[model samples]
Target: MAVKTVEDLFLHELSDTYSAEKQMTRSLPQMARAAADPQLAQAFLDHLEETRGQVERIDEMVEILNLKLKRIKCAAMEGLVEEGKDLIDEIDKGPVLDVALIGAAQKVEHYEIASYTTLIALATKLGYTPVLPLLQASLAEEKATDDKLGKLGQAAAIEEAVQA
Candidate 1:
């Protein structure tokens, strides 16, 4: 991944995103289990399925581009997932834990938002018209997930306040 050209950069980013999506597929289930709120748990599970589709969309992009995907692990995603795991291990299961889970999930969603945004920009510059829709779809999903997590976090905070 020398990224000598715009196309090279696009492929590198796309491959990195592919790795990130794969990482999510593995981590989302664990997050779902860690969630104390049933809704939050179901949200994680729902996103797991969406993440799978996102991975498939990337696969489609690869097919259309006639490129072999580079085998690269997304270090950023690895770190994010590890941080979420740490939160789960440290926190007791309750509303507070559910709030924490929302925070952790939002962090991941934010990372994905940035990743997909960059991918879209690179794809546009590289004239990857076919993959633009795929990138945009993933971006929309990421944003929606972020918004959902934010609302969950807010509700948890309000409940905690009322209890206090």
Candidate 2:
């Protein structure tokens, strides 16, 4: 648990990411249900599936590295998820809520992007060649999800919400 080596840091990050993905898997359904926009709702559902896959990939990496999955709570993700839940509770279900949801979701995506970026670099430095592909795959998905959210924000949904 001490910050002794790169391997230790890698394991800590892996556990954090695993916890984040698991939290997302549980949170996405609520987000999807709260979304009034069909596209936004569907996006959350789609990302839920992607998050599940990401979790599996992390499990595979842990297995490959011969490391046991630790229950290290991702505090960042926990706070983000709580903020999202608060957003959902405070706002009425509508385009405005959808826009707010998109904002919340994008924050989650950005956190993931940063986490995976660090993870991929660390993996490469540690000679985790086989794990690179899995990390890269998740990175690409997170980027794509962020882009999708950006597009959703630019769509008429947010404008309508602002006017409403």
Candidate 3:
């Protein structure tokens, strides 16, 4: 791939995040089902729905970009999800597995936050003000979800899993 200028990098980040969001549409279900905590499960489910809309918004960005949907697969997420799966497999079922899964999920969220923040800055730099709001909205959603996961993890998920 050619080295992208600032604008190109922005687009690349947007598409990469686009792929990450799409991947989450699939990943969240597994996390939700794996969760023993009702709050965690519901959180995953809610994020799934938000991700669906995010995919649509990213599609709009792709159109604004006048580019096709392309993906540079995010190994970070794939690796994180895989690690969570491994932890899930090793840990006994119950709150322990749930906590482990939440930890893994939060890691994924953090990765996303970084990606979105970068892209948002790039978008603003590239003078794409219209796209900025769309990007910021998704960024905010990711942060909120992360916060919820943090709270859930601290409240019961962590303690429950550690006990197991």
Candidate 4:
């Protein structure tokens, strides 16, 4: 796709995020299973559900915009997920692994935050009024998930990992 206009970029990004959310849904279950901490596991599970909802929102946006429902594979998310799989395979299941998982998960959340922020800004500029709310909803969820992971890391995962 050639860079012609902001609308083109917005569609490109929307497709990218749609793919990322789909990838997360697939990877998150494995992440939950790999977590040593129950809380961390539950967070992954909860986010899996949220990711599903985000996917639906993306679909709605596509329908509203009358855009083709095509997903551009987000290479960044693919790399992040591969790194997570490497962490799971290399690390022994324990506090250290849990902390590592939190770090990996936070990285994913941060990526999502940045992606959504850009999409929301583009949507607003494009006068995509109906799509703005959906983008904002997903952005809010991503930020909340990042905050939760940070609290979990500070409260327990970090200390336990350091001791281990």
For all predicted structures, in order, the TM-scores are: 0.95, 0.98, 0.92, 0.97
Task: Please give the ranking of all candidate structures by TM-score, highest first, separated by commas.
Answer: 2, 4, 1, 3
- Tens-digit lDDT track of model 3 for 17-102: 87778778888898788877788889999999998988988888878867665558767777876787788779766898887887
Decreasing lDDT order of the candidates: 2, 4, 1, 3
Report backbone clashes per prediction. Answer: 0, 0, 1, 0
lDDT of 2 by residue, 1-164 (tens): 67689988998899999999999999999999999999999999999999999999998998888988777899999999999999999999999999999999999999999999999999999999999999999999999999999999999888989899
TM-score of candidate 1 versus the correct structure, residues matched by position: 0.95
lDDT of 1 by residue, 1-164 (tens): 68788888788888898999999999999999988788889999999999999999999999998988888899999999999899889988777778878888898999999999998898888888998999999999999999998998887654873474
Top-TM-score structure, candidate number: 2
Superposition TM-score, candidate 3 onto the true structure: 0.92
- List clashing residue pairs in candidate 4: none
| Native-referenced Cα lDDT, model 2 | 0.95
lDDT tens digits by residue: candidate 4, 99-149: 999999999999999999999999889999988989999999999999999
Candidate 1 wrong stretches, greater than 4 Å: 161-164
Question: Where is model 1 poorest over a 10-residue stretch in terms of lDDT?
Answer: 155-164
How far residue 121's Cα lies from its native spot in candidate 4, in Å, is 0.7
lDDT of each: 0.89, 0.95, 0.82, 0.93
